[model samples]
Target: MADTTNRLAGIAYLTVDGTNYMLAGDFAYSVSKVARETLMGQDRVHGYSEKPKQGSMSGSIRDAGGLSVASFNAMTNVTVTVELANGKTIIGRNMWTVGDLEVKTTEATFEVKWEGFSVEEA
Candidate 1:
């Protein structure tokens, strides 16, 4: 199952007011537009159109700049711990700031092990 397609894709057309959250089995990414069918006139003339929406893909990792977010906006000096189904855990610290990742998620099992340092405005 580890090598299987155990991933999820989702979009978060985020704004200053709301926060969108998605739980995926694997990796997540964002997209530009969403297509929809529109009708016009007396006839149900359906047409495809685009909208400002988000999308997720399997085995896709996005960067923060791609998401149009600043590094300072995200958490800094953080540590991550990944736990596989085999009951083994892998820990990484100072890997990158939150601003480095466009999308980040922590599963119920693989928790944020610890934090060594944090960002501060000087």
Candidate 2:
């Protein structure tokens, strides 16, 4: 078995339209498969297949700094590239849209959520 303890923190980031965002602070990403089953006959045997589907990415960033929430808020569609802690990268390829944006004045931070038609690791 692989040693889980060897894992270390890596860069978590997102790029929209070739512009880098979320270079610092805490962030997370996840991808899930969309699947369906087809019944073959009265016997109830079924064939199953799956494919990449819509995904979500969320995280919080401390200090607004140079980050622009307005740009993301006005966006209807965007291409996002996310680098995970494990050194894997996922590219949304113009299928993503910013879903939510929240700014906390007391904490001087902001959080964002993005949802898309599909997501794949590249």
Candidate 3:
């Protein structure tokens, strides 16, 4: 039997400008911040400052998700929301696509990735 350890089951959706698209398999996201740096001064460590945080989301489009390269390229103020079956919600706001999307017909997969201004978990 296969062991199901730490498996995540969820649904992810994207709202570009104002349109919403339900995502398919391989959905994932992450949040990160700049590495803390130690100030170098005359004597020793001084203090730490605030660092910018970044969020990213990636997923495959469901069949007939109605995603268009023209519209995606012109997107502004994008947002992505993921709802896990574990009763957790992750929201990414003010996002933009990182690069051109790649569509593969063999497996009916359309991959998309976005970098966002912030990520909120609730």
Candidate 4:
């Protein structure tokens, strides 16, 4: 049987540089491999080849305590830990680099973007 659990319903949070930032409304974390393909000369059919390249993990967090803003302004690499609702955690090495920070006055919130490498589930 296939597992039909709604994992998204579980709470998700991120800890960056020892500061915990909870999801404000939405968040995204994805890893994609860069691929290159080569096509062979075709008699009747052609074959394709590909290779996987280094991938990255990126996402945004709701800047609750203004710590994320400070971190970004400092231009520092931080350790990241993502804790999911189902008790699984994704940990990243000290390679996380802070990116753009969006501030919305109407919503009274700040959104911080981060990217990192060497992430793994634990």
Q: What is the C-alpha local distance difference test score of each model?
A: 0.32, 0.67, 0.68, 0.59
All models, RMSD in angstroms: 15.6, 5.4, 5.0, 5.0
Model 4 misplacement above 4 A: 1-8, 31-55, 65-68, 73-75
The positional error of residue 89 in candidate 2, measured at the CA in angstroms, is: 0.9
Q: Could you give candidate 1's per-residue lDDT for residues 1-122 as a string of tens digits?
A: 25524433232221111222222344222232454657565776666566543222222223333333343245344333333333333343343332223345443211111222221111
Question: After TM-score superposition, what is the CA distance of residue 105 in candidate 3 from its true location, in Å?
Answer: 1.0
Model 1: clashing residue pairs?
A: 7-26
For TM-score, the strongest prediction is 3
lDDT per residue for candidate 2 within 68-93, as digits (tens), equals 77766776577778777676787765
How far is 79's C-alpha from truth in model 1 (Å)?
0.8
Q: Residue-wise lDDT of candidate 4 within 26-94, one digit each (tens)?
A: 555544444567686756437667776433445544545544466564634666677877667777665
lDDT of 1 at 120: 16
Model 4 clash pairs are none
lDDT of 4 at 62: 52
Clashes of each: 1, 0, 0, 0
Higher TM-score: candidate 1 or 2?
2
lDDT of 4: 0.59
Error of 4 at 119 (Å): 1.5
Off by over 4 Å in 2: 1-6, 35-53
Location of the lowest summed lDDT over 10 successive residues in candidate 4: 53-62
